[model samples]
Target: MNHQDHQDHQAVGASVDRVAKQVIDAGLKVHRALGPGLLESAYEHCLAHELGLRGLPVRRQVPMPVTYDGMELDAGYRLDLVVINFNARLFRDGVRRFAL
Candidate 1:
């Protein structure tokens, strides 16, 4: 890649890293406040709220589309939480999936 392209990629990576950190921090805050034993949905809602309070746009239960045989289809797969712009997917099991 050219110098400009490299710089752009670095910038995007930095942004993703920042957002990921924020999401992680927010999730921790939620967990610490609520503790364990609650349903996954409870944690998902709380985390989304916490992230929103942190100024991150969050969408819950986002449908994920898949490509099958060159066709885009809704496979009933849903993301627990999607932090907009950064496209960070947060689940209750502390497993993070990013579509950056």
Candidate 2:
């Protein structure tokens, strides 16, 4: 494999989460099934297949445009994972509030 190919795979390899170990396991399962002969798209589809079996939401080719001054900036990259509305709650004086 070329250096760039090695870097590409490394870039997508994230630290496995204990709570999300199942996700990583699912990815590995896909990898094992397809092996290394297929293209990246095939691997992604297989991974998504496993994730779907686990009732996980998988959005492909999700566009994540950056915004500046209320203008949408079409950056060249997209986010693989976008978790929205994960803000924690804060309670003080018997009042519930959203944490920044």
Top candidate on lDDT is 1
Per-residue lDDT over 38-65 for candidate 1, one digit per residue giving the tens place of the 0 to 100 score: 9999999999989989999888998867
Top-TM-score candidate index? 1
Q: How close is candidate 2 to the true structure, as a TM-score?
A: 0.55
Candidate 1: C-alpha RMSD to true structure equals 5.5
Each candidate structure's TM-score, on Cα atoms with residue i matched to residue i, is 0.81, 0.55
The sequence of per-residue lDDT tens digits that candidate 2 reaches over residues 57-82 is 66665665677999878896664432
Candidate 2 local accuracy as lDDT?
Answer: 0.57
- CA-lDDT, candidates in order: 0.81, 0.57
